[model samples]
Target chain A: MAMSDLYREHILDHYENPRHHGTLADADFSHEESNPLCGDHVRIDVKLSEDKTRIADAAFSGEGCIISQAATSMLLESVMGWRIDDVEQLDPQHVLSLIGVPLTANRVKCALLGLKVLKTGIKLWKLQQMQHSA
Target chain B: MHTQREFFDVHAVRRDFPILQQRVNGKPLVFLDSAASSQKPLPVLEAMERVYREAYANVHRGVYALSEAATAAYDEARAKIARFIGAPAVENIVFTRNATEALNLLAYAYARAFLREGDEILLTELEHHANFVPWMVLARERNVTLKFIPLTPEGLLDLDAFERLLTERTRIVTFAHVSNVLGTITDPAPIIARAHAAGAIVIVDGSQSVPHMPVNVQAMDCDFLVFSGHKMLGPTGIGVLYGKRALLEAMPPFLTGGDMISYVGFDDVRWNDVPLKFEAGTPAFVEAIGLGAAVDYLSALGMDAVRAHEAQLTAYALERLSEVSGVRIYGPQDPQRRGGVIAFTVNRIHPHDLASLLDQHGIAIRAGHHCAQPLHQRLGVNATARASFYIYTEPSEIDALAEGIEHAKRALRIS
Candidate 1:
């Protein structure tokens, strides 16, 4: 495939001007992950609503390839008002569809890095919540 | 010098490598990842095939004629490699799976046996993971201390810092003869002199250097030198570990099984002699023969000419790359101090993105930490795109790489 096919206009836009591209200071939980193969890193900070049932806001910060940073930007923008449980149920295929590009096996990791960090963060936060309640 | 240059024609050399004569992504393939692993020449490939077809048997085990022939070929390969590196004796060269396995062998057989608590092992920031992680693992298990020789702002090893890091407690000093990422060549003579004065034995990781330049372990006086075959026009699954005669004789075997033992006993085992003691089981005899053929190929070309060719190519690459705006090249600006590897980043483009863009143009370059994460962290960059050269590389390939980078910049919308 040509470079243009992968780095489309929308992907470039998200990469150049990422949405929610910084940490939320009063975030309920945060998690950071790195793709060891390429040294690409992504950290996700999420803030829950007052009722703690839905994600009020989510921001991601990291340095990496265009697909990773842009995918994270696009992912955060799509899931801003998503229910916390629904976000947990988000699968890897959903992330690939969100990327909207055919990726080689190696690059699939780059595109999914954001979702991996976000899902892992939510899982850890849930674990902490359960501990506090107990 | 001009006559030598004329004698070693790169176009003639390029013809020997069959893989270079192909198209990728509808463009002529421009391979720039030789530092990762080089393309094999016809001689090496033919040697391997001839061995499989004519003389195929388990080496050193069979008493039959075919086995003897295979054994003779394997031993001849060892002798060729020994001569290639200026090793004193063929007995000093021990074969392993690759450079990584060679380094691990030393860590297990030497460091685990000799290193004590609080003993310091000095290493450089320029080491690839193959040289670094083994020592790190040893330190954790043996309660040893690991110290690093810092790098200068120009990415060269800080010799002053190296001298300061040397101490009486320093038991081992190991560093790469050349940095895989920066392509900076470290002169081992002075490092070895000082390390010996401090009572530390020096190990040189020659994975990058040996394939590019003339190396003499005897002249350098290093205790151990490790390099892989695949990076030097040989097939995979074969590497060399050259040690001083006494050192190899003294160190216990790292891996033990059938061929390595002189006699196997349930109560006690008598190990075979030095080189054989280290090599166990059915070795990669055919691959070793291929490596022997590779050594012959390089020897025929003359390493001095190979070095001269790469130096000229590197100088030209640096100049061409510099003309492109916003291109930041790593390593020493002077090509004399570096090998033919150029690592760089263009504008704000991520290396992976740039690599993918270049792939569309059929230009292959490495994009990552290059297995030197500590050095990448020191440079304050996650990754860089690297283009490395070898015997068959042409000047037009460099021009193609530079043009490809410009094309990549435009495609990524980077001004």
Candidate 2:
């Protein structure tokens, strides 16, 4: 318990010195995802590519416990260059495995915060596409 | 622990709650959320067990041996609750599913009997939804106004706001004896006095107080008081609502069925006595007995000791959590006037993360809106982490919580 495999130094480094923690409100699409249970909220913006094949640029703004904010920050970094298919197929295990196994049953939601926001953004993008087609 | 300190011994009291023996993740159960619902002691469980084993029959309807025994036990349980809360008589004690249901009963009976257009129901900003929603729905139905007593800067009830809100139009003054979130104990005497002077009936939601502190319906002099058995270490689906005799007699029954009517023939009926007039169906006999046992058990220890123990534990928890940098505690920061409930949010870390980290160490706490959505909104947070304590809680558990929180901070990489 003393040496947590779940909370690695890298996670701490990313959490303490967060990258791209602000927002891009001028971006094409912005969505907010919040878990009311634990007071975790993330506002995400995406400037989608004209082709819609890959995410062009992404940035996030949020305040939560470390798991939520860091996971969100890392997730934004992880998905920026990847295609929609790659992002959709991207397993949360990859994110969790990297962080180590310090999570208990209830804490899984915090660790999974990034994945929820990323998925929600993708869903909102698809909805917007349908709206334009109509 | 000064109040009733000589009546009970803490070491002897620890052995009563069986849940303490259980191990989770190879550690003893460090339960810190009794406000949610307390674990049952052996006495309560056995009371229910003994009823099922020896006397298992429906009450008030049957005349056989088992039926008579069951009816007697049920009535005896009501009498016990009446004695426990210092109710004027057993007839004033009406059993409902829980405190929520007891409050609902008031709404149903009052809506039918007293409510009308332009009436107002006065409530506080710091109320659990159970206490909030019933009155809200009632206000909607009666086309009445639901006025809230503004909270003080420190999360206590703004007594001036409460006094100012009262008018001839105010039908009821509803408030919690002790806030479930803040644990701030309100001296309900003056509030009840003001409400009565304004011709407004008073309803005290005693779910939080009856379990931890001594309550006398006569002394409080409120129109009604409601509390749940489960929150006080009894079985669920059982609660007590004590109304003044005149008030109980005047209000219409909330439900209609057999046993509540004294005479029924050809579409004509006469309702039964005071308490039975409200309890319409087959009552929770076993649970009622268990609640009686729970009342006995808590009384044996004494409310004064329980309050003192919780005060010490709450102070310890507040002191420890405050020591951690970047931790923002909620509710009244002063621990002396507060009960054992403490809610906090760690900077750069989510409450879910803190809860999960603590769970691994077998320390249990509550996180989220905690059914007190308004308080969360007032604090300008959507959610927070809460840890509540009871008689069995130990100082070591607080240390464990602190240790677990530190681990969460490091793991999340928050300062």
The prediction achieving the highest TM-score against the true structure is 1
Q: Over the stretch B124-225, how does candidate 1's per-residue lDDT look in tens digits?
A: 998899999999999999899999999999989999999888999999999999899999999999999999999999999999999999999989999999
Model 2 chain B is weakest, by summed lDDT over 10 consecutive residues, at: B1-10
Model 2, position B229, has a per-residue lDDT of 92
The TM-score obtained by model 1 is: 0.96
Interface DockQ of candidate 2: 0.45
Residue B376 shift from truth in candidate 2, angstroms: 2.4
lDDT of 2 by residue, B341-363 (tens): 88888886667657766776788
Model 2 ranges with Cα > 4 A deviation: A1-22, A26-30, A46-59, A70-105, A108-134, B1-7, B255-272, B316-328, B332-336, B346-348, B402-415
